[model samples]
Target: MKNEQIVLAQRPEGLPGDETFRYEDTEIKKPDNDEVLIESVYISVDPYMRGRMNDTKSYSKPFEIDEPLNGHVVGKIVESNHENFSEGDVVTGGLPWKKFNTVSSDAVNKVPSTEVPLHLYLSTLGMPGHTAYGGLLEIGKPEEGETVVVSAASGAVGSVVGQIAKIKGAKVVGIAGGDEKVNYLTETLGFDEGIDYKKDNFSEKLAEAVPDGIDVYFENVGGPISDEVFNHLNTFARVPVCGAISSYNSKEDNGPRVQQKLIKSQALMQGFLVAQFQDNAKNASEQLAKWVQEGKIKSEVTIAEGFDQLPEAFRNLFTGDNFGKQVVKVSNSLD
Candidate 1:
C-alpha cells in the first residue's frame, strides 16, 4: 500500500501560501514491535501549528523544511504489533499529515467508547477542549456573579471557555469578528452579551457589555480587542493568555504595552500550554465529557472534506472562515 503525506516545503515569512506545502506519495511501512498502523479519519488544523512553521525557538520545535508536518489526528488502527491495540480500535494522537501512519502504540490514546462523533476527539474532547478546560479553570477562575470576557469566542477554545464560565454562574461576554459569530455566541452558546470587534464602535460596545468590569478575560485574539478589554478590567482581574492569532502572521508584532493596566488593576496574567496540566488530563476529560453528555456544554465543528483540504483548513483559522474547531475529514472511520 502507498501513503500520501503533506510536507513543509519552506519556512514561511508571513502567512503561508501555496508554495509552503508539498505533497508526496510513498510506500506504507509496516509497524514493528509495540507499534501500530493507523489510517487517519479526522485531522486537526490549529493556530499553534503556525508557530511551528517559523524557524524561531519556542515551546514546540520548528518543522524542518521538506519534512512531513504533524499534529493531532484521529485514526483507526489497521495493523497492530502492540498488545494493547487491535485492528479497528479508534485512537487520537500527534501524527504526521499522512493518509496512513506507522507509529509506536504509546504515542496514541484509544478513543473511549462514546456516542460523541469521532471528529470531536480532534476538537472538543481533544486538545482544544483540554486547553479550554485547563486554562480557564486553572488561571481564569471565574467566580459566581463575576463577569467573564472571551475573545474569538466563537472559535474552538474560546467557545468552550464562554460556556464553562456560564456554567460557573458568571456573566459571559463573547467577542468575535462578525454579526453571525456574535449571534452564535449570544443565541446558541448562551453568552450574556456578544461584541463584534470589527464594528466601528467596538471599544464602546465592549465597555457597555461588561458594566461591572471584566473579572476574567480569556485572551485568544490579541491586539486592539485585548487593549479594549484591558481598559475595562476590574481590580484583581485574571487574564489567561491562550493565543494571539492577530499577530501570528505579522512581520512585526506592534501592540500596546499593558504593564500599566496590570499594575492599576493588579490583575494576574499568565500564558500557558495544555501540557502543563498533563497530570489532570484524565480528570479534565472526564469532567468535560460529563458536561458535554449532560448538555451543559456544546461543541461545534467546521469540517473541510478530503485530505487535500488540509492546508486550506489550516488557513481558515487565521481567516475567520471557520466558526468552531476547524478539522479536515481525511477519511471515514471503521464502522
Candidate 2:
C-alpha cells in the first residue's frame, strides 16, 4: 500500500501558507516487534505547533525541513506486532501526519472505551483539555466569589478553563473576537460575562465585567487584551500563562510594560507547559471526563473534512477561522 504524508517544506518566516507544506507518497511499512501500524483517523492542529515551524528553540524540538510534521493524532491499529494491542485497537499519540504510521507501541496510548465521539480524543478529551485542567487549577487557583477572566474563551483550552472556574464557584468572564463567539461563551458555555475584544471599547467593557477585579487570568491570546486585563488585577491575583496566539506569527511581540501592574497588585504570573504536571495526568483526565459525563463541561470543536485539509486547518488557528478545538477527520471508518 502507498501512504501519503505531509512534510515541512521550509521554516515559515511569517504566517504559514501552502508553500510551507509538501506532500509525498511512500510505501507503507509493516510493524516490527513491539510496534504497530496506525491508520490516521483524526489530527489535531494547535497554536503551539506554529513555534515548532520556526527554527527557534522551544520546549519541543523544531521540525526539520522535509521531515514529516507531527502532532496529536488519533488512529486505528491495522496491524500489530505487540502483545498489548490488537488489529483494530484505537489509539492516540504525537504521530506524524500520514495516512499510515509504523511506530513502537510504547509511543501510543490506547483509547479507553467511552460513549464520547472518537474525534474527542484529539480535542477536549486529549491534549487541549489537559492543558486547561492543569494550567488553571494549578496556577490560577481561583477561589469562590472571585473573578476569573479567560482570553480566547471560546477556544478548546480556554473554554474548559472557563467552565472549570465556574464549577469552582468563581465568576468567569470570557474574552473573544466577535459577537458570535462572545455569545457562545455566555449562553452556551455558561461564562458569567463575555467581552468582544474586537470592539474599540474593549478595555471599558472588560473593566465593567470584572467590577470586583480579576482574581485569576487564564492568559491565552496575549497582546493588548492582556495589557488591559493586567490593569484590572486584584491584589494577590494569579495569572497562568498558557499561550500567546496573537504574537505567534510576529517577528517581535512588543507591548506596554507590565512591571508596574504586577508590583502594584502583588500578583503571581507563571508560565507553564502541561507536560510539567505529568504526574497528575490521570487525575486531571478523570476529573475532566467526569465533568463531561455529568454535563458540567461541554466539548466544542470545528472539524475539517479530510486529511488534505490539514494545512488549511492549521492556518485557521492563527486566523481565528475555527471555533473550539480544531481537528481534521482523516477517515470515517473508525467512527
RMSD to native for every prediction?
A: 0.9, 0.8
TM-score for candidate 1: 0.99
Q: State the lDDT of candidate 1 residue by residue for 196-292, as single tens digits.
A: 9889999889888888899999999888788788998899999999999998999887778999999999999999999999999999999988998
Q: Write candidate 2's Cα lDDT for 159-205 as tens digits.
A: 99999999999999999989889999999999999999999999899
lDDT values, one for every candidate = 0.92, 0.92
Which pairs in model 1 have colliding backbones?
Answer: none
- The TM-scores, one per candidate, come to 0.99, 0.99
Name the 10 consecutive residues with the lowest summed lDDT in model 1: 326-335
Off by over 4 Å in 1: none
Per-residue lDDT of 326 in model 2: 92
The CA root-mean-square deviation of candidate 1, after full C-alpha superposition on the true structure, stands at 0.9
